[model samples]
Target chain A: MREKQIDKLKDYKYGFTTDIENIRAPKGLNKEVIEFISKAKKEPKWMLDWRMKAFERLKNLKEPNWQKPKYPKIDYQDIYYYSAPKSASDKPKSIDELDPKLLETYKKLGIPLQEQQRLNGIAVDAVFDSVSVATTFKDKLNEVGVIFCSISEAIQKHPELVKKYLGSVIPLTDHYFATLNSAVFTDGSFVYIPPGVRCPMELSTYFRINASQTGQFERTLIIADKGSYVSYLEGCTAPMRDENQLHAANVELVALDDAEIKYSTVQNWYPGDENGKGGIYNFVTKRGLCKGINSKISWTQVETGSAITWKYPSCILQGDNSIGEFYSIAITNNHQKADTGTKMIHLGKNTKSKIISKGISAGFSDMTYRGLVDISSKAKNSTNYTQCDSLLMGNKCGAHTVPYIKNKNPESNIAHEATTSKISEEQLHYCQQRGLNPEEAVGLIVNGFCKEVLQQLPMEFAVEAQKLVGISLEGSVG
Target chain B: MLKIKNLKADIDSKSILNNFNLEIKPGEVHAIMGPNGSGKSTLSNILSGKKGYNVSGEVLFENKNLFELETEERAHKGIFLAFQYPLEIPGVNTNIFLKTSLNAIRKANGEKELDAIEFLKLVKLKAKNLKFDEEKLNRQLNVGFSGGEKKKNEILQMSILNPKLSILDETDSGLDIDALKTVADGVNSLRKKDNSFLIITHYQRLLDYIKPDYVHVLMNGKIIKSGGPELALELENKGYENFN
Candidate 1:
């Protein structure tokens, strides 16, 4: 029994793929493919035109080469741009009408769509393949003036809000992968918290990629209106495959005057096998704009999966007295590579930003914490504090911290601190002597090292993230 | 409870112990006094199942072969080693570590694990009995602790786990007189007919308080002299060089 438990911890538990049939768009990335996606979603002309604009801009942009880890060149034309469950062709009007197979898939992933089995205090939008399958507790949210639904539903039902804020935070011409996401993105969750109201429950989206030879492009946009507050979380998982998959997502957030938006992500996508055979290339763009006075936006992410992860969830402080905070814990193991951190851009007077990042690399993986903190000259009295820490396991893995700080304001203060540490054998031996197994010892130590960042997560996500922090490094200890 | 016959150990082909023999019965506190490089620490490390050593011996604990067990497995079977230099694991709370360790041992022995309240109560009582500051339990394990405080923490852990066989490897080296008394008092309180201790030290000062059942003078990886509590006094007076 103990051996089986250890074996369970050694392998990725979410590697099983559902054998459901899929309705796939023609494999390729051309104007016709983009048109097919837009038309299939029954999007309005303006949204289609926006996608075409992004597609045209994508032609001039190139896949970024600045990241530390490089993979084989992706044949964009070979990947199926859209793949959804066959039963989800015409979206279900209610959770009861949803296909049992899709519901079973999410249920097996520990997310029960059945009302009675649903996790209390959380409203979840489960996205499979390329589209959201079901969103629970919709009626309760609608009563509170909360707009929570799939992005596709939002584009049709709330076009004015969608058109106004779709690309407000991350423009279509942001970067290559982000632009790619903007062009071919199929569906994701959309949230809007009306002014002067505190969201009654946590809003979450779980993304699962089940189809083969497909690219999952999801777009999530959240807006917290004046005096409103919301906490949003995201989680992702993909089936184990012998071929690499692409998951480029764009997440944007906007906070109006006195509004607060807290975003957390526990990304546990398949990180390939121990030999680095295949995995997802998680290139994502997540940014928030504190556009109104006294607004605040914070991003907390625990990234433990993905073969090649390259993203920096950033914040742009454009309103006076606005605050931006980023707390992240990124772990890479078993031939995985990640270069993740946060970017804090201070553009308004008296704006404040704080960043705390913890990166742990094990096995033959490489991890980097690359962050940027820029305080503009016009932002008088703005203060930014950053703490970046890295932990490496064994001599085979590598950890690096590259921080870019631009302080043009003499009146502003920017404090940047970084540390690089390795778990010592003596510490492991001591823990083992105290009766903890090698795996538990490493987990406890790593969790302790990431206590500050973990504290930023919500109660439920914090517990899950803590376990992932341990499981991600399983077998790294000899 | 522990029997070792003709045990030999080598690290990187450098011999550390050869022809070493000892038997510790239940409830016996045996002190092995030796100078530097006399294999006192090697014996503890080998007995506690530390890797990187080429060991060949017959070591039985409660009639079970000790060599086949992992470090934690040995700990599960009731062996506890209070490290000479207790490691400072930054960020691991002392109280949490103690609870985890205690629960792990309990779970391994098929005993019901203690909940937080019960564990905290046990820790509180044990800390008080050892005269240890309870507030420090909330801080990172061994981090920023003085030498004496670290030693006391190891003793506190020993008392909490309540292992059947306890090995103190030079635990009294950096302790002051008052701390030495507290540590000795902790060990004395834990003394029972079913609990045993192996105290490895260079000085006879600790034995003066704990009162070991037997004292052995070790030199050059072997026991050269063995006697009652008077053996420790004789060795301390003559010193290792002349006694050998």
Candidate 2:
């Protein structure tokens, strides 16, 4: 049998420390900490009350243990609830005013925050150490009536809009990570596309976790109004450390009548050292809703980082004739573990959904694909197609699939297909006989396995994702 | 060009080839004919360095120790083997596979890589001569190919790679008269003074197209007879029962 190679997260080029003054609240979790965070952001009273409710719910909730990856004891009390770079009221007005260290960090990552903003035509929102440093291309976006800004700013400027859709899709009480993120989310991007408008350019955000002993809880909310369209990209990287860090983020997307949202994520968070000593535990909740007729939502993710990942980006197809799609390639190498997939809930008539998931497990890691496809009785003649494939690289690594299907309507047509294969020695020998080394042979074979998923990404992003896949499983095979 | 001395091989403690010896000169086409249960296939497997064989022998190619070299290293040294059963690799296109392979060999010989345009030009030329469908080059390697097409593909690969010493392991196993001519023509086009060929078959039908300079009869674990071209015809007229 041929074994699949799980990708490993290397010390990324963006892995750099930024030294700056940090204004931090005391460690430990309680009502006082939640209130301090809300007051620090100067949120409205109603928003604070909502967070308090989420916090109350979190206090009684226990961590779910049915996942395939084992969880070590996480000390929630030792994590700082709020740790900002500096001044809460006076944000940096330009790149020149921002800390040189902060600017230099992005420069090393090959994304010049200010220069690229003008030359690359990509609007960037850089979040460093629990605060939004700068958001570029604002004037051009505003000309087209696109509200692209930090969520913190959205709360103060467009209170009614933020209040109406903050938790519309993924409610605060949805899951453990979602609830925790609602109570302590410091900063994340928020976009609202006006009715009948299509955003001219792509909106992107780069999240960085710098301060030590601080957990990152970012809440991203995007709402596309009726007949509007938007494309959003999320990227993340963390500095190397000897102690494990926690990142629990919640992302909620809402598409109104005839609206379409294309969301892509390139998650390259730090996966522990070669010996599996320290890394980040990423537990995120991201979901989108087709609330209006003819609406559509699609998610594409390339996850090659994190010590342990627990995420399920889902879609609720509620509007008549709405569509939902998911494409993902999750690679786990070394001692890393990942339990990630998607959920499609069809509630309206004639709805449709498609899921393509590819999982690669290398080294001593274990990976599982957990998904749910629910077709309610009202979803008359709905249709769904799912394909899940797993590739194992070494004898020690493991890959498993657990799919749940609940079809309440006999009229609905749902099909599921899955296959698991190892990289065959015969194939490798054939390549080696032709003069390719074992590493090069593995690269060619693994790339072929992931070509389908990579095609769904944006042009430039697809190239980056391809290289990430190759780099992740570099030394695991011949 | 090649020398195999005192070759002794076994699989799972069952000896297949015992004390096998062969010597080939440059520009010579040698054929080894044998009945079933002989060590015909084992010789090819041992020379190509396929794992799981308990082989003890001295295989000298280009006056160098071939056994000490890795599979790819031996390939770089200009030793090529066309398998009897070519493995199918799904999702790996033939174009990229051939390019990577050719470049690996080229780089080992201190040659620069041929880009997509240059490589495609060379592949199309060889592919056309072998009468292969160019559309199949875009598909996975040997995947869903007919028997005749696979044999033709093996010959095309051999011609493109241009190895010095080619071992044709039962290349005529599944080819018809038409395919035999095509495969034979592919081999004859690549024949040169500095190169040699080892054609292993069970009958004299293949030798009719690509005539061999010498023929040997292998039975049990070792070769029992060696003669000129008429030896193949003699064995065809009088089967191996008399030799045993």
Can you list each candidate's DockQ? 0.58, 0.43
Model 1 Cα lDDT, one tens digit per residue, A301-343: 9999999998999999999999999999999988999999989
**What lDDT does the true structure give each of the candidates?**
0.93, 0.87
Q: Please give the lDDT score for candidate 1.
A: 0.93
Candidate 2 chain B: worst-modelled 10 consecutive residues by lDDT: B45-54
Name the runs in model 2 displaced over 4 angstroms: A1-21, A35-46, A84-90, A116-122, B24-27
RMSD of each: 1.9, 3.4
Question: So what's the TM-score on candidate 2?
Answer: 0.91
Quick one: best TM-score, which candidate? 1
Cα deviation of A285, candidate 2, in Å:
0.7
In the range A17-88, model 2's lDDT, one tens digit per residue, is: 778778887898888998888887888898899899999999888877888888788999999978888743
TM-score of each: 0.97, 0.91
